[model samples]
Target: MKPLLLIILYCAAVTLPLLASWLVGGPPRPFRHELASGLGILAFSMILMEFVLSGRFKKISTGIGMDVTMRVHQMMARTALIFAMLHPFLYRGTASGGQRPWDPTRQLTITTDFYDLSSGITAFLLLPCLVLLAVGRTKLDYKYETWRLMHGIGATLIAALLLHHTVYAGRYGSQPVMTWLWLVMTGLAIVSLIYVYLVAPLRETARPWRVTSVTRLTPGQWEVTVAPEKHPGLDFKAGQFVWLNVGHSAFSLKENPFSICSAPAAGSKISFMIKELGDFTRTVGQIKPGTIAYLDGPYGSLTVDGRNEPGIALIAGGVGIAPLLGILRELRQTGDPRKVKLIYGNRTDNQIAFRDELDEEDVTYVVSEPTAAWQGEKGFIDPALIDRVFSPLEIKEWLFVMCGPGIMMDIVEDHLITRGTPSRHILSERFDYD
Candidate 1:
């Protein structure tokens, strides 16, 4: 589906509960009380929707690029946190007591019952902590897998707590129609989690892969190739990535996203150029050639399969060259007539991967900290290097696909825009959403 339609659907889904609550009319309450209820309803709905926005669903992520989808997820999460934090405070001045005989719909008095309020209190305390941990995950001293597990568990617990609070303590939610709506919404959220952690793993288990080779490309980088055991292998575009689980259980959280460095035309075998960063990546060189593995993707929107641009510009920094290499390889294999050029940058010349293969292409090798014997472009892949590499007409007309460090991408994107390149022609995927 198109991005605009997906966005429209997302907005409609998130606001469905609030619209339903408003339609289920009750005795009129003060604006403050209604506002509190509305905020609470919206917050709960958005939280439930976060499961789908986790970037696991291809329908959502593929249409809007994984980076864009993740950015939306992060922004919406913070927004929902704000709404939830203000929900209870807005009801402070409203009447609160046991259910009164006259207030059948609980319009005149808010519930003070321990059972109804306990869940809300607990969720209120936990919500901020969850958001804070997520926002500061990279800075925290924990494994990525550990953070992922904690985030999943914490979100599930909070959702359950909020469900109880909303259906029991909420004035609008207490109504039968609204109660049913909340229950259904929460059920879907749980189902989404199950689909990701359970169903997907089961499917991956059935279609396993075996490592064929592990070749060191640089001091800190290795190329790991895997072939499907019996299946025909992944049918993915050239520049996509997959969640690779090597020598681990299908359901393990040890999997990490790695870009496909091999072209789709390169047969059923797939290759990933991994850098030794941290966590699972640090163990890439240690992995044996015949180890069992599972793949749970082919996700990302960094391909140039059907573009009509006159040329293609590939910009890379460090390990970001993985996906771009796949694209370049596919273009060469297909005998594509369009012009292609690559600008690959690294901290040092020794850090560049696939030197023999890349040297065969129209590549500009750049090193931020070059050795005395180093040649080619020096310094980072900045505006000056970009201007030196491509002509003004090429910058405006060529399709630019980049993946790299956040700062490099930011600089490249800004320069591309400044050089009269339309946003639609500039494509990038980020490793870090923050």
Candidate 2:
């Protein structure tokens, strides 16, 4: 459905722009150039919408479509950036030219009249686009919030400048009807960006949650609880995640989605047990109690959304147990009679962060290492161990929710695949780095 919508929108945007240019007596070169740019922008928008609508709902771990979609979006954005920058450069010496690219260097030593002011101002925004592409993925040392804000501002500046230039100087966009169409298309892109930024954050703030307590769960792990002050905002089913913002300081800029660890109806605070693995997680320990935190959704398709199988089997490793805890707590709250078996792995018994919580829950624990007086299942979870525990008949009727280390999920997925389990039957999530 999303692909169909994208195709329709792309054709309309391209055809309308070309027809409008022809009707306005626009030159052949400018019309062809602007049409190409419009198509690129349309392609970029379609890829973005497709990811938002369908990428998150996919059950399989890997697919060719997912890879292609990501690649298309990235390439189209780069292409649009180049074309936008070059549009003014081609019109440098023309009477309609506003600013020259070389104006900045010339103004360094003395006053200049050779300035094409409009194009130069537009080119200034190119700096941000180049920087953002250079630091793409936020994989560098910069903070996530800082990078996101800068990237957003840069993209906005470019779009605004491009829109202004096209309206005033573009030959195709000079006529009233053509100008309105150009403005409308650009407006949609800006609106989409606003939805991604301003609108989404505002929606998140409406969720009811206040910081209750923070405790150290492991060497660098903190378990923070956010209970409702008055009434619960919404109950989260197991296997769903909420987008969280710590305080107003970085609220708008930094919204990291973390899986809920407590049941939605526990009458207690919602909890998130996170390891200090990154810059954002590291600062969570300093979060004071009574601080207001905004939560945006209980999103994701991994939850047991009523698949009437024989039972549910859950697997987790280390901090990945957060989502599994949500499912278990939810099951207990709803009085679900389905038998649930959990196989959780960790480096050692001591590092099993929520030991007390797991022991209290109606689930099995598979600890990898136990030094003294250890009596639980030992060693890594492999295909042989799973086969020994459950028969083929039992496996067929069981719904598997596997989360944790990516490698472990891969091994379990492969084992299930070998046993002829459909990929849709097994659900997993991992912020894995390739």
Candidate 3:
């Protein structure tokens, strides 16, 4: 499950169809035409593989981390777009028209069959729109759920079009063996989508969860807890997260991911420290207790369990503290003997959540904009603050787990590297994937 191994497996899956297509016997064609076909095959294969990559498979996300998995998904989509864009242009020198009796194999003549060519044209147009919308999702005015639904539907349509075009028009794909392979691969991609929306929702409907309590932790932050109804609670590691759906059907796309803020040892009720940030999140304060809720997670690889480091360093910015708080509470309730310290940062004093429970002896609360009454550390959670809190030996030897704004994570990670901490020793989760 190491990262390199995952990459190797992924490369094999995406390139397998391309390799097979090339291996199938065919009359010699110009290198440009063959290259075009190969690129098209590779693009479609990569597009289908995107479904598996974005399917939230723990085998992939848990191994390389969700941030890396998502990043790879985005990069591959763009790469596939480039290949798809260039595919047809490279075949310009080949003869194009209706299929001829003389060139039955499509060896010397490109197909001008309207249905076959139309599918390819449709996919080419739709693929760019899908990629552009995804790249600019945050810039547009739309709900995250709305954007998610559009993205899913668009990608599925493009996949179907690409499959039809590949099997019907492709010289290699017209072979019985290649046609079967394309069908199987495309079927698997659709199955992944079905599993997410249909199969998983059906299972969740059987084991429902309900809102147990909602407590205001700060001005804009609330801790909402959900308890299993007639069921044992989720069995998850300390620093994982869940996709929470409150007051929505199990099949709804209104779910939003939030890290578990309460410890597993705290009992069957799991709580999330949510800030008013979006359409769903901004209304968290109004979500009454006893409302129905559905959970689909315990995802992410941010836990420090079983680590051999002598000290554990937790760094957080804003509500990114949710998962870290779970880790901190777990370490305490279990009476973990390892030395632990926390550096929680915020822009203003009132933004810090769960301040009462944080053991002042080990927690450093940093505020960039402190009121006159402020007494704790002032300024950003930068290298200077980090150096002030952690010893040189602890910096190099201890485990560093962090989740926060992208800027803060980058700064902390860069500083950790500068302090000679091994990359493996530093763990981080990104709140905004955009």
TM-score of each: 0.98, 0.70, 0.97
- Give lDDT: candidate 3, residue 348: 96
Q: Where in model 1 is the C-alpha error above 4 Å?
A: 101-105
After superposition, which runs of candidate 2 have C-alpha atoms over 4 Å from their true positions? 1-138, 161-178, 195-208, 249-254, 360-381, 432-434
Please give the ranking of all candidate structures by lDDT, highest first, separated by commas.
1, 3, 2
Give the number of the best model, judged by lDDT. Answer: 1
Candidate 2 has a TM-score of 0.70
Q: Give per-residue lDDT, candidate 1, residue 270.
A: 97
Clashes of each: 0, 6, 0
- Report the C-alpha displacement of residue 387, candidate 1, in angstroms: 0.9
Q: In terms of TM-score, how similar is model 1 to the real structure?
A: 0.98
Runs of candidate 3 with Cα error greater than 4 angstroms are 99-104
In model 2, state the lDDT of residue 319: 82
lDDT of 2 by residue, 213-299 (tens): 999988888888887656656555667776787766324666776888887767556788888877779889899999888776656
Which candidate, 2 or 3, has the higher TM-score?
3
Candidate 1 lDDT (Cα, 0 to 1): 0.92
Per-residue accuracy of model 3 over 1-434 as CA lDDT, tens digit each: 78899989899989989888878968888899998999999999999999998836877787777888888999999999999999999988678986578877556778888998999999999999999999999899999999999999999999999989998889888888899999999999999999988998888898799998888998989999999998897989999988899999999999998999889998999999999988998899899989999998767888887789989999999888999999999998899999889999999999988787885539999999999999999989899999999999999999999989898889989998999999989999764556
lDDT of each: 0.92, 0.64, 0.90
